[model samples]
Target: MAKSATLYRMATDEHICPFGLKSKDLLKRKGYELDDNLLTSREETDAFKNKHDVKTTPQTFIDNERIGGYDELRSYFNKSEAGQQGTTYTPVLAIFAVTLLMAFAFSYASNFALLSLNTAELFVALTMGVLAIQKLRDLFSFTNSFITYDLLAMKVVRYAYVYPFLEAFVSIGMIAALPAYTVAPISLFIGGVGAVSVIKAVYIDKRELKCACVGGDSNVPLGFVSLTENLFMIGAGVWMFIK
Candidate 1:
């Protein structure tokens, strides 16, 4: 016999519970025969809530046992919490993938070549630029998490705030093909400090922590990926200086 589940979710003219949709989708994917009960009015939703003695909508039941909300449902199924929770590489991988594709597109458009030195340069520059934007979105949060592992940020404190801006500036200079003298030093300084910090924190110290590379709110772990980012910056700096 197929498994069975029941879901009570709110769907009003003014509002629709997103967790409800997620629960419904998860049920289908898990091969559950779901009885989707929608509370279409404020009164109806509140009544259901009060009856069940629960605080939230999107309540799911398995085998007639209450399974709580979306998070609870995920827990029951041994699924990771979606978004900025626990360790994940989705954000960093996504940024790298998109930036590489963009680099290819730009290279093909400008020089009629999909792969070139320019493409490599553009990829690094674009990655830096996008990563900076992520940091800038939540400067306070980023700095708080950043200082936990970044050597320069830990000592200076203010460097945490300045770091994103520096990345942005370096990215702009690289993309604009500005004089190497103007951009290379800053890149080298930040990248060198970052690389050392990651090595000390993850390798030497053997501390496991979330990386602030993608942003302060990120769930990316501090390890090889973080080290790779710093290495890329270092490589970009040296390449720019030499060529």
Candidate 2:
């Protein structure tokens, strides 16, 4: 005989249990014949729960043995726990995606062809501005985190607080299409400093630390993404100066 499972779930006019659906799908995927017992009303559902001596719906039974809830079902299959992973580049990626979209929109609005130099500049500027704002969200916290890995911040504490504003100022200048002579040098100075700091902390010192690139509270590691941000700024500044 084929293995079979029974699921007791609640499905009413106003509400249907989501976990119940998940449990049912899991059973189907595991090749178990499901005997679905859906309580159609609130009273029926309450009575069923009370009768089972359980506090929740979506209860599963396999061969007359209760198998508990969705998480429990996953555990039975030895699957990794859901939603327990650490942070990644998702935040920075999201910001970059938005900046690129904004740059395209601005380029179209200015009657410039798509993918113009102006669009590229604007994209870089907007990305910096967004990142600066993230740091400014909790400036003190960012400073505290930055001082741990930033070479300059470690020596001169005030630089930690001033960094975000400088980034924002340079970003605004680029976005406004101001004279590159003035903005480019500032960009180069800050970018060069940042790159040096990150290299010393990550490569030379081999320190494991959280990057303040996104903000102090972020879980983004102080590695490739942080280095990329500094290198990008340096590249943009160099291009602007020579162009």
**lDDT winner:** 1
Q: What is the C-alpha RMSD of each candidate to the true structure, in Å?
A: 2.9, 5.5
Reference-based TM-score of each model? 0.85, 0.67
Model 2 C-alpha RMSD to native: 5.5
Q: Candidate 2, after superposition: displacement of residue 190 in Å?
A: 1.3
Model 1: residue 125 alpha-carbon error in angstroms:
0.6
Give me the overall lDDT of model 1: 0.93
Candidate 1 structure, TM-score to reference = 0.85
* Tens digits of per-residue lDDT for model 2, 159-228: 9999999889889988776788878888888888889988988999999888999899888889888888
Please, what is the whole-model Cα lDDT of each candidate in the order they appear?
0.93, 0.88
Candidate 2 error regions (>4 Å): 1-84
The collision pairs in model 2 are none
Stretches off by above 4 angstroms in model 1 are 1-6, 27-36, 60-68, 71-85
